[model samples]
Target: MAIPRQQLLVVSEELDEAELAALKFLSLEHIPMRKLETVREAVDFFHVLQEKGMIEAENLSFLKELLYRICRIDLLEAQLGSSREEMESELQLPGRAKVSAYRYLLFQLSEDITEDKLKSFKVFLGKELPKCKLNSKTTMLDVFIEMEKKGILGEDNLSVLKNLCREINVSLLRRIEEYELNLSGREEVLIPEEQKGSTGGPKAQARGQALSVASDSPGHWDESSWLEVYKMTSQPRGVCVILNNHSFAKARAAVPKPKDLKDRPGTHVDAVALRRVFQKLHFTVAEHRDLMADEIRKIVDIYRCKDHKARDCFVCCILSHGKKGIVYGVDGEEVPIQELTTAFTEQNCPSLAGKPKVFFVQACQGNACHKGVTVETDSGQQDSSIETDTRLQLDYIPAEADFLLGMATLQDFISYRSPRRGTWYIQALCQHLEYSCPRGEDILTILTAVNQEVSRKSCNKVEKQMPEPGFTLTKKLIFPVS
Candidate 1:
């Protein structure tokens, strides 16, 4: 049994003497203070953190203001192992940037963040803050506090918040100083009547800039103002091409089915489920069954020629037998994944340039099968593209970014198929997509949940399987909320 526990790690944007003293008083782990210039920089930082542990940090929703400052999805995805869609989903949180900005406003408005002003802020929150499918939670401060409970936030997040505020506006520096000096000695929300106006502090007032965005109720905080930028929402979205290769010619004895696979009935189930899922996403689902490896290339070439200028993304699924780094066709020949992806690379196919191109492969990557190990319970965890060939080098990055490959099982492992249901990976993926997408989840996030779900199932007593998604998506790829 996995023991549920609270772990501590101090995160700070800056830890001056006073903040350092607070750390001593709090008795929490004091992590090194670091600053991020890019999401990749953060990724580097997290990698350093992973040396200490797995670096499985919770979603840093509070720092979205900082992300907005950077607004680089590659960095976010690189650091968090998330897709652009995943981070954007988090960025839209109600108080992502607003709460911190509201604090700055409070410092400036010492006496002006009146109940009336606060109401105006609420109106702003409803309008500017991207509505998370969350339970109407608002503000970075609230999210930060929740993280602190999980021991996810510490001085590091605070330091980052302070730094983010300063980057957003210089006036924040003065407001922060005032906030730290609040005689209350306790962290209290700035009140209008209780605090005297900034009439006594002219220099602070002189440096202060007016906050144009609305904020949380009074001391409450909410969305981005300066750094919150929205990713382009595709006009017609995109289409899904599911190439499910279930049956091979009996004469092609070299491509024999697993003894119990039961004539590929589950694959049909997968095709049906996936079609419905993508159709609900308002995507045109094109299903091609029993294609040869070369034929697969032709289909991608055709898609590349189609006018996808209006589409936001693309999807392709391969359901068949496979080998390491390769999937098999109905003809029993191998198709290197690198070949499948390169067909639509920006260099080869400009139509999908910079757009998310996701490939879902429900084939075994290796002959290894999971011998059911003891299942571990996660107390509260949660959780594309292509190019074409000329024998694309798997060691090299895709010419274009924003591509993803979701593998059914780990490298060299066999993926399980249920005759009554379908492949474990596809079923879990479809189920999780339905459960999470409407909740503002991006593709990567839904896949993570799918990974968690599939990883836990018992294939045959002790046999187990796990699905993992790999991507270089530069932006978030979210299906339209249904």
Candidate 2:
């Protein structure tokens, strides 16, 4: 049965901006980002949910959960004919809730984060998201939406959230840890019992014999073997393409005065660090410098077209100026980040399908500067100065899996650089890779370390930066150093 329009209208009329935003955030997994962005009112959002088959007259469970999640108990009781206690009991059943525990946890965290920490959180994620998404009026719910769009924050992928919470408030990390533990416990409890074959049949006896023979064989798989990880053991582990755009002479002439990009003097430091690290990890590093937008695409196409059947993975690093959703070419043209990533999809680059395609972008996502929080410590402070790659700029993985995108900073924020030492993000990334990869750590763990390390550092003792990593990998990706 279809839900009556009048009832939806009545409930929609009761929703304010805060409640509406909460509903949208909770519905992110159900509705597409583009469609959700166009929804101007609660009624419109409900319509979209209905269109997606998420809400109906008979299936009002999702709506009830949404109202419950937002703590609109009055609406739940009056409109949905459900109460908070009923929802609590219903949600306790296995797989009963529509909104994931992870999503609910984020919403709860958003509600709990203080205004000052919220400001700090926005600054930390400034470069990984779009400028419009992180304005002065942006809320924690808004930040989580952008993070989901970037594929950084999700039910399964919570490293970025965990890192952010650890930096902002160590206490919050406990919540995530508990959630993970609970998930593990549930998985263990949900394991199915093996089905028995017919008691006195020849087929059943044959099946038992076959099972006995298979178990006796040396090749027989164990329970531990079920936990599969990606194979990163290929020699010269695929191609590592580094598009290092250091000079921007053509950009200065092509772009207007205010948007004129400066030459990245210390980019070579990053290039050298990346080359050394990847070389140590036994990768064939192909470095290109000062490429235009078209040229950048062509270079990626060249790698994408390569027959990478012999390779275990692919890596591409872009170092340049950018704004939200785009990176600037040396000649002042724009390259949509999505274009480069989608080019290597299973349909586009068949040879690299099923293999991890890692992209580490070292560019500004926007022009916002991250303000650092003052820490009270007994140690005396030393004077220091830092330069920022503050030019405003702009996830390629969509249906296709096995991709990781590590951004220098959150969207709309500036990432710092040193004329001599190299950019904070790239340098920290290389350092962590060098240390962690050799110790058998996976790529996600290494990126988390990078996030922690970069978030702790401040330029001029007032400005800070945080790196954001997003991935759709199906298995653990550990680089073999030897």
Candidate 3:
């Protein structure tokens, strides 16, 4: 019943004047424009795009980025219906001053950016520019063009990106809601049909039994047990805690107030998608909304106090506002990362013992804003961290387990947020979890997907935050793809 197609080719040459103008706003140095061969296919693909939740526009630049961005208009539409006046007021407000303010604050924190170096940064912020398109075959440029065609660069209209970041950052207080969700219950992983054969069933049962015994055994075993027994099935336990923190009561003063931060429908759309995906994979997700650090310490303390009975693996998702190694409490206080995870340390909570402890922090790490990256012929040439202080202090701590740390951005840097939607890191994390978790994708595989999605879907200086994962697992995990 499905049409069979092969050697699918898509070329983007029918770019009209406006599209062409949009292209000039782009950095096309690395795009492989000459290799494309199917302009017709690309045009046709753009035609029915709206049916798949695409936004119908006389212009097709937006959808050139991701299938997900199309759903954003539905977000816009819902906002229109809820409060037209508020939406109009925001849209009409002057964003230049606010943008300048954010830029100033960021500049004060780090000298990695400047006005003279903001051309590429402006491109990421979605500023309008002349007509242009790719003129080469560089990988970075190629990826950027691909995203531009998908319209994933998003609307920089009225400085929406800054507003979005402010709005989403406020939702970090919702971490409490995540904790409640985790306390309520967790989804169970289902057995696959193919593995239902008699031999397979017994084999799986035996393996499960063996895993249980090994997981329950005490540490400090002889070298043989470490290699033969523990190494056979030892793994870091996975914990998912979704916390909601702070309130919009003290919202950012950015003009064009973010739609999602105002409780828009698309708020946390990406994060919810990921939670559901991970839930289906039997991840113990603690979905809390609006929790404070004192509360965070208390909850982690409870887990630490009961480490003997605590889960061997750990995954903590802190969805809150942050600066550098510190996240904001609902009271506007700073809570250091060391303070939060100290509960999991051997000195505090020894239950986790020698397992994997993973923390996925989805908040701005600092006030440092996105600066234009120097595009080089090799994409790998870009420095991973703009500042020497980018890596978290946890990197230096002698963690008991193979602790893995995942943060939204580098040091002294603010992660990108979607005014009414979720933070970029959270959204990407959730999407990858949904797409790959249920399929039994390994932790690394899912993280890879998250990295690719964020890198591909976003650009510009301020919005170009990526999720960085540091791990120390004894063995590789493949999430058991079914």
Candidate 4:
């Protein structure tokens, strides 16, 4: 009746002191399931049993009892903080922050599904299914297959499940089985008193059978769980192209200059800041300082080829004086926004097909800026992308996913810039990112702050304009992980 020395040693070595005491308490005196230390430890203990092939029916029952005990521990923890330590002084497990942290870690660990796969799963859940019900004892595979037939699960569903399994730790999949068994309660049957010892082996075998379930389980999720969703940080790797067509074919051409122009076209802050920020971000930025629309499209096409396999994300920032829907190329040719964005449709760029493709435009969409009401309306901030008359034209493929276009101003407006400094939008954007991007804040949040600061500081400048930010992020993005 003595436990094996190796098993005892393994258990002792693997578990912390509290877990060891809990195990001893369980084995020696049938301690309450709630008396253990951490549910994570309990999970680990169950895993050890599984590895030892000791997952008996009674053990599974023990697991269920333990989980409920832990659930109560969680409830208690939710109600109180370190008070669990006081509970532990009386020999009960504390479940508050401990459980919260575990759940959050679990969700982050489980985020292996692609954004599209997530979308598909949501659609399947929302749609009615006459065939499959949660109450049925159908396998998860069966439910998935049925959904696949009903056009619910796309071709990528298998990959999603595989990735999810990998991310959540395949061991947890087995743990999930034990959790299911824990829900079933004790399984009592007719047995002779003398044969009771024989039951342990069968109980272990039964527990092993309970691992794979068909549907989602509604477990308690706390704020930690919410935080877990932010763990995923995969960003698209699209090419960023900046084309400034405002310059002459020759940098020093004697063209019709704006009335107060001092610096020539090539030395604009828009070009300099664009290059500096993109290079810092480690993007393979391509710049065509004065290319026509065709040349720009040609460069884009080179990167768009899937066979060549360029990158996953795409960005294009155009800097020039422009008419509505058209950015001025070097030769003053009009490059329509639709023409620029069209090169990145799903058909042309399959690698970025469902990935985030961001476009930043700095051009006059129209010509409606009148003389200012007051010459000194400036609040001492730099000028912004000018607001103009013509609206920007955005043509996107109906089904293409994850595209974001950040325009300097609203549609049909000129973006402003100073010859000495950079464009208002670029300067503010860089300033905000340099200062506020390190706090694990979302890109949108930082941009909003940037917009407010820019608006407040520059509303009274001569070319008075406000920087605008627009995005189509499929999910949240936090930059500079370090």
lDDT per model vs. reference: 0.50, 0.71, 0.41, 0.43
Ranking by lDDT: 2, 1, 4, 3
Models 1 onward score TM values of 0.47, 0.49, 0.44, 0.43
For TM-score, candidate 1 versus 4, the one ahead is 1
Best candidate according to TM-score: 2
lDDT (Cα, tens digit) per residue for candidate 1, span 370-394: 2222111100001011112212223
Residue by residue across 1-482, what tens digits does model 3's lDDT show? 22112111222333343333222222122123432322234444433333333324333223322211112233234322223333445434554111222222222212332333333333443322222432222222233344445433332211122222223332321332232233222321111101111111111010110101112222212432333111212222355666656353332332454211222122355457547655654566667665555776777676667644434466676766655567655444457876776667766666666655667776654333222321111001112332335333345224555566776665544455544445556666655554344444356655655554454333231134455666655544444323
For residues 1-482, what per-residue lDDT tens digits would candidate 4 score against the true structure?
Answer: 43334443443354464333333233312332343323345445555554544445333323323323333345234322223454445333432212222222223323333445444443444333453342234333333434445533332122223223433446644443343233222221110000111111111000111111111221212322343212223332335677765544432242563221112232256676667666555566778766755776676677666432444456677765554456554554456766667677778766666556667766544333333221111011122333332323343222455666655554433344544444556656655554444434555655564454344333222233444454445555445534
For model 1, the local distance difference test gives 0.50
Candidate 2, which segments miss by more than 4 Å at Cα?
A: 1-226, 255-259, 370-395
RMSD of 1: 24.1
Scored against the true structure, residue 479 in model 3 reaches a CA lDDT of: 46
Per-residue error (Å), model 1, residue 403: 0.6
RMSD of each: 24.1, 24.4, 21.8, 24.4
The number of the candidate with the highest lDDT is 2
* Order of candidate numbers by TM-score, starting with the best: 2, 1, 3, 4
